[model samples]
Target: MTRKAAGNAPGHAAGNEAGEETGEEPGEEPGAAHWLFGDQLGPHFIDPARGGPRRDAPLLMIEARSVLRRRRFHRAKAHLILSAMRHRAAELGDRVRYVKADTYRQGLREAVGDARVTVHHPTSHAALAFVRSLPSVRVLSARGFLVTHDAFGRWADGRGTKHLRQEDFYRWVRQTHDLLMEGDQPAGGRWNLDHDNRQPPPRGATDLGVPAPYRPRESEIDDEVRADLDRWSRDGDVEFVGEDGPRGFPATRREALAALHRFIEHRLPTFGAYEDAVLTGDATMSHSLLSSSLNLGLLDPAECAERAEAAWRSGDVPLNSAEGFVRQITGWREYVWHVYWHFGTRYRESNTLGHHEPLPDWFTDLSPDGTDANCLSHVLRQVRDTGWTHHIPRLMILGSLALQRGWEPGAVTDWFHRSFVDGYDWVMVPNVVGMSQYADGGRMTTKPYTSGGAYINRMSDFCGPCRYKPTVRVGEDACPFTAGYWNLLHHHRDRFEHNPRMTQAVRGLDRLTDLEALLEQERDRRD
Candidate 1:
C-alpha cells in the first residue's frame, strides 16, 4: 500500500528558500492525496504519492484555458508547467492521485465522486455551475498577485492610499527595500545619476561586444524546441532565429542568463550614456539586452536588482552605471505597470490628434528603388533587419513620426508591439502611448520628445544617403521630419506653445514667418 504524506516544503511557500520541494509527509495515509485537473494544468505538476484531505495530503488541480482558439499553437508554457509539476510530484511521495480527464465535465464528474478533491478544472461553465451549485462547496478569490479580480480575500486597503497609482506603489517598493530613497538609509543615496551618464560619443570607432547566442545544449530543451518549432512552423511567419545559422535565438531561461551576464560585464557601464544613440554596425548600442529576461519572469526582479546594486556597492561599477541600471529595472519598469492598470484597456485607443493613418508601410514594406522613403524608413528598417530599435529611434523617430503625423495611437501602438521581440502589453503600453505618444494626458512623461532630422543627422551616419535632406524642408527631397516639425508645432500650438520649456522652440518657429506655409508643403510630401 502506498503511504500518504503531509505537507512537504515547497519553494512556492513564500518564506521557503527557492529550490525543489522536499516531500516527506509523515503520518500520511495511503489514498489520501487527490489531484484535480483545471482547464489548464499549471506549471506545478502534482505528486501521486500522498495527495488527500489529510494534513499531509492536499488537493491539487489544473486551471482552465484563459481563452479558446480553434487553431491550436504549440504552448511552450505547457511544457514548462508540466515539467515543474512533475518535479514537485517526485518530491512529494505517497498515495497522491490525479485525474486524466480531457474535458472539464469529465474532471468534474470525477471531482464530484471524491469529496477530497479541492482543486478543479471546470472546462464548461456548466461544470462550475454544477460543482458550486452543490452543498458543502465554496469558492474564493485567489490571493496571488496574478489575481484579475478580488473574491473573498479582496483587500480594499489599496484604495485612496499609497497604492493609488503605480508610481506610488513602486515608491513603496523602493522604500520598503530602501532603494534610492535618501541618505545612508537608502541603497546608494542617489535617486538617479542618469544625467551624467547619458553622454554622446566623441569621434572614435566603437567596439561591438560579442553577441551571446546559444544552441540548445540541454537535451530536453533541444529536442522539445525542435519539435515545437516544427509544430509551430505554420503559425504566422515564424522565423527560426537560432544558432546553426537559423535566425531564431534562445527560447529558454538558461540561455537568457548567458546573454545577460555578457551584457552586465561588457555593456552595462556604457549603457545609460549611449543607450539612446544609434550608430552604424552597432546592433545593441550599449544597452543591456536583458529586457526580455526580466519581462518573461525568467529572472526574478529583486534578485536582479540586488545583483546590480551589489556590484555597485562592491566598487565593481560606478554610481552612474548602478543608478542608471536601477532606473531601468526599478523605476521605469515598475512605472510602466502602474500606468497600464491606471489607464485600462481603452488607453490604447487614444488618438490625441485624431490621426487615422495606417502605420507607415516602412514598418512592413522596404523599397530598394524609391525616393519617397520615409524619414523613419531607415530606422524602421533597422527593426525589420534585426528585430531591434534602440531607445532614441523608438522615442524620437517612431514616436515623433506618429505624433507629428497624427496616426491613431492604437495603430502606432500595435506597430510598436509587432516590431520588437520585447513588446508586451505592460512595457510597450507606457512606452508607446505615454513616452512615445504622450497620449496618456501627459502622465508618464512631461514633454513630447520630438526633433527635426538634424538630431539623427548629427548622431548617425544614416543621413548621408537618406532619400531626404535633413536641412531642406520645402523641397521634394526634404526630410519630412523637418517640415513636420513646424506643422506639429502649429497644430498643437494652443496646448503647448506657451509652456516655458516649449515656447522657446515655438518662438524660433515664429521667426520663420513662412513656417506655416513650409509646414503645409511638408504634409504634401507624405502623400
Candidate 2:
C-alpha cells in the first residue's frame, strides 16, 4: 500500500537492489524501515552516516491505537508524541509512510506484508518483545542513549550486584565517559556535589525572578494534532486526561534546541541549589524541563552533559550545578535504563512492601483545584495543565504521599507512565515501582523515599500555605503526610529496625506514647 522512494544515497544499506529477493516477489520492493512512535525525530532519522534512516529507504511510522487504549494518558503527553511523530514524518516528506493502526503488530504486519523488515530495538521491554516475535522483522540496536545495555551489564557484572548503588555506577560512568573529570580525579575534587545542591527554596519575592516559561511557537503540525485528538475523542472509546495547551512543550528539534540553550543560559547556574525546592506558585523553578525532549531523542544526552560541563569549565556555571546536571543524564538516567533491561518484565511485578490500595480519585480530576492539600494540588495542577513537574514534587510530594498511603505499586507506576510528558516504561518502571514506591524491595533505592511533612516544610514553602499542621502527628488538622508517615513507620517497624539508615526513623516510633491512637486516627482518615 506504500510507494517506494526513487533513487538511493551513496553507500546506502539497501543500495540500488531495492526490489531484490529479500523474501519478496519479483518487482516487489524490500521491506521499509519501521520507526516506532516513541522513535520520533532524532539524529537517527536524518544522518545515515550516524546509523540513521537512509534518505532513499522507505520509513514507516504507526500511531497505534492499542497504546492509547492501554492507559488514560495525559492529553498533552499524547499530543506531544503524536505531533512530534507527524512533524518528523512531514519533514521527511514522501519517503515516510505514516499509518494509524489499531495495534502496533498489526500496523507493522500491514506495512511490511511478506517483505523482510528491519526495526530499531525499542526502549520498552514490551515493544522489544513484540518486535522480536515477528518472523520477518530484524531488530537493530537502539541509538540515542549515552551508554549501551551491554556495557552497563558488563559494569554491573564487575560490581557484583549486592547493593547496586547509583553513586558507584555514577563514578564509573564519569571515569569511563570522562565527564566533569580533571585528570583521574573529579573536577570539583569531590565525586558528588549533592550536599552543596541541597539548599532550600530561596525566601522573599525579590529572589524569585520573572518566570521564563518555555512557550514554543505554534505550527500547522500542532493544529493537525489538535484536530486528530478532537476527532479521536468524538469517535474513539479511548479516554485521555490532562490539558492540551499550545504553549506547553516543544515537539520539534528547533524548539528543543532553543529550550536547551534557554536552560543553559538562565537556569543552569541555580539549577543544582533549587533542584529540590518546591515553591507555592512556581512549578519550573530553574529546572531544565528538557527530559521529554531528551527522552524523545530531540536532544542528545552526551551533548547536554558536555554543554553543562563547558559552562562550568568556563566559570559561567558552578561545579555543583554542572556536575549535578551531568549526573542526571549520564548517571541516574543511564542506571535506570540499565536496571529496566537487566531486571526484565518481572521488575514491574515486584511489590516488596505489598502495597495494594487504589490510587486516589483526585489524581486524574481535570480541575486544578482537585485536592485540599496545597502542595499536592499545586503540583497536580501543573501536571494536569502542562504534563510536567519538577522531580522534587514528583518524588517528595506525590511519590511520598502515595507510599505513605500504601497505594498499589503497579497502579502508582502506571499513573506516572500515563501522567508525565517525559514518562516512558523504561523510565517509569524502575523509578516509580522501585525507587519511589519501594515496591521492588529496595532494588532501585536504598530506602523507601518516604518523609513526614517536616521534610517538605524544610525543603519547600508548601507547609506554610497548607491547611494542615506539618508538625502535628495526630489531630483533626494534622497533615495527612505526617499521619501517614507515622503509620508507615509503625507498620514497617520490624522490617526497618535492622536497617542502619532507617534506625533513627524506626527509633522515633518508640517516642510516640499514643502510637495506637495515632495509627487509628490515620486509618480512620484514610478510610
Residue-level lDDT tens digits of model 1 in 275-363: 55666656566677566445444454444555666667767766677667766775676556545555556667665655677755434
**Please, what are the lDDT tens digits per residue for candidate 2 over residues 70-104?**
88999999999988888877776787788888987
List the candidates' TM-scores in order. Answer: 0.67, 0.91
Candidate 1 backbone overlaps, count: 37
Off by over 4 Å in 1: 1-173, 180-189, 206-250, 365-375, 498-500
Best by TM-score: 2
At residue 251, candidate 2 shows an lDDT of 81
Worst 10 residues of 1 by lDDT: 10-19
Backbone clash tally for model 2? 0
Q: List the residue pairs that clash in candidate 2.
A: none
